[model samples]
Target: MSELVDLRTSGRTAVITLRRPAKRNALTIELCDLIRDAATGAVADGARSLVVTGEGTSFCAGADLDAVYGDTFREALYGMLQTLTTLPVPVVAAVNGPAIGAGTQIAIACDVRVAAPTAAFAIPTAGNALAVDPWTIRRFSLLAGNGAARAALLGLEKIGADRAHALGLADRLGDLDDALAWAAQMAELAPLTLAYSKQVLNTVFEPELDAATAAELGKSFDACWASEDFAEARAARREKRKPVFRGL
Candidate 1:
């Protein structure tokens, strides 16, 4: 329904594409809303599985700088990521190219990822003196192991598609066509089985935690958004220079 995102179904598989190539499929507030809507709408439209990818040479470059520094953006982004993470139908990521920042989040949110030759992933939060929530960090650790997680989040390493597949970050490496075929195959399986399996996996490692830990994690991540380093990073991007993070 949204011009920002295009949804099309193929053999019971719904494919959602981020359609903004000019900005390298960067996520805006409106785009985030459309992404969440597309996921829900696909299920409502009889889709048994879902695939997400980008329109051009990128899966997603990340969130638009202008929209990513505030609480509104964080709330919207978390909602979309959370929805995709817990979607009833299996969600696959057809990672066409470089997926950075929020783009990385979208890919990891999916139940499976099939990457193209050009596909690469990075969070680069530390490079900007920023941070992600504890849940996201924990998920990355679980998916790729503590080594890769620390490298990506702390050392600012970018993982190529092949290495990602080897690290268990990506399930496979292929084009959009291959990803769609995989989605179709998944769609034909029993829906309830997939749903239950997904739920079980999600909860298996979820620890019953205190409210204080949750609050602390939230505060630490939000604090980065309002810091001088965040502003420095934005300015550096606009000026086409390396950000000199002061850790303030």
Candidate 2:
């Protein structure tokens, strides 16, 4: 079977590509599981940095609504979001096109985001008879400011790449190549320092977020520390060799 997501490594950087262009890279349950597995695997492989981007015209259109309406599906979606937040390495979302609904959520879960000039972002959940999770509401408010958050949730406003950057939703305006270059640069840093730095920065932002929300996000970090990847990383440095993580 074809892989739902594609993963490749260059030096210490892991690039994860969302491959379902036919669906505008809409996130399905299987796709979410693949992403979570890839993120965990990249860390186990001793990757210092990670980049997530789409295969074609869209970064992600959003969740597969067909799968999200059911109660069981909602639980699975929540679990996937929890998994995404805990990636050990720094994650950069290279947004090449539109990012709506859950797509916006995925991008926000990353540490940083770089968007192409063609990229656009929106959250239209209100009209769809859906409400964003409490954690998402709080995080979006903190990240995009209360006004923008309300406009997104209540007004269903769609913001373009440039405007999104201006509003702080995207950290930079760039294409996929630029994002890859940035990831490569980040990969050259000392691993321990980078990990610790991410931890400290997360700590600073943790307070602005809801306590329950922040705790759920911390689960990924806790899993990382307890995984075989952590031990392999330590040994790889001592042996002057690259780590081969099993994602255990």
Candidate 3:
């Protein structure tokens, strides 16, 4: 039994709710692994569609600072992201509130995203001196255009649901219940057809980075996470003010 996540199926839809409201459903290694298992298990349990949401206001506030910020955390998180995307069944991200940093990655990995009025998305990697993988950056760029992508990645701008929908980052606007209804409707579709289409569409334009490119990206990410700017971000969070980043 997973302590951090709740998986319950209703008819042909499986609902996976992140249960740690106190921490804004921040993704821990255990929680991320449970989500991966839930994705596979949901399909095995006859769920034709899956809905992922948070228990409270926050859909997911990104990685848990207490345990995340390390290579192990990134490995688990990247694994979970792949699970969300590559599962045989369609995954709906019910963004009920703010989805920050890595949380935005999870939503983008899903087949569809329906965000509520209160839901907002941001990937403030620059503020923390962190960098996402090449695939992630490419996906964001392709999904919302270069300007929006640069806004989120470089400017650290928060894109609300309305802007996200206009930018093609979010498919619709609604609450979790609306998201569940949409998933239930999708459940009536042909499984094999959906599966095949998902595979083709997802892989059609995916660019594979060469060995050197991939290694360089990893090294860059490591360097950023280990930088002095990252430490200032943490201190700023505790101090409750803007983080003054120095390009160290």
Candidate 4:
């Protein structure tokens, strides 16, 4: 099988590309492990910055449903997300297309996002009968807003790149060339300074803002599990029928 992720270094910048286009670059366990290794290696190799992007049409469609439906795989997936959160160097997401569900999670895990004009963002977990991870929900709320994040998660709304930029989900909206230019600029900064700055920012954001948001997300997940829609969807799926989710 082709490698799930590709990593390359250009000068002081490391570019990590999600390569599973056949699956819309979904975050699979193997793919997540590759990303974790790449991020760690980039820092160890003295790279000043890391840029993550998708290889083809879609940036990422989220977690691989077939994989995550298994409880063990779901836990592994969450562990990978935690690994991303702990990366030492600044991680920049070069969003080239649609980023939904776990795709949005990965982008938000990065310190910044540079999205293409054609890119779109969404998190339809509530509608899809799944719950977004706690960190993802908090990160989204911090990057965008509680209201905007709720709209995407709870209301299942999709926002275009322009709107995402305006809402603070994306730092810039441009093409691959623009993303590369921005990454080059970031690579020029002192590595220690960049790392320290990212550390300080995370320190201030995590315990205060993110902690509370994460707790709320857990509550939301519990609510989702207790909902009638969850049971109905489960039943419908087993019966090989289309689920009419009411989002109860």
Q: Can you tell me which runs of candidate 4 are displaced by over 4 Å?
A: 208-241, 245-248
Q: What's the lDDT for candidate 1?
A: 0.90
**TM-score of each model, paired residue for residue:** 0.95, 0.79, 0.93, 0.86
Sort all candidates by lDDT, best to worst: 1, 3, 4, 2
Which residue pairs collide in model 4, if any? 62-102
Q: Candidate 1, which segments miss by more than 4 Å at Cα?
A: none
Q: Estimate candidate 2's alpha-carbon lDDT, on a 0 to 1 scale.
A: 0.79
Q: Write model 4 residue lDDT over 1-248, tens digit each, in one string.
A: 23888888877788899999999999877887788787887778888778889989999999776565445556666666666676776778899999988888888888899999878889987655877766677789998889998898878999899989999999998876677778788888777787788788878777554667768866777677567786776777678787798768
RMSD of each: 1.4, 14.8, 1.7, 3.1
| TM-score attained by model 4 | 0.86
Cα error, candidate 3, residue 6 (Å): 0.8
Task: Give lDDT tens digits, candidate 3, residues 146-176.
Answer: 8999888888999999999999999999998
- Report the Cα lDDT for candidate 4: 0.80
Clashes of each: 0, 1, 0, 1
The TM-score between candidate 1 and the true structure equals 0.95
Residue 216's lDDT within candidate 4 is 81
Task: Give the alpha-carbon lDDT of every model.
Answer: 0.90, 0.79, 0.88, 0.80
Our tally of clashes for model 1 stands at 0
In candidate 1, what are the lDDT values of residues 58-87, reduced to their tens digit? 999988876675878878888999989888
Indicate which candidate wins on lDDT: 1
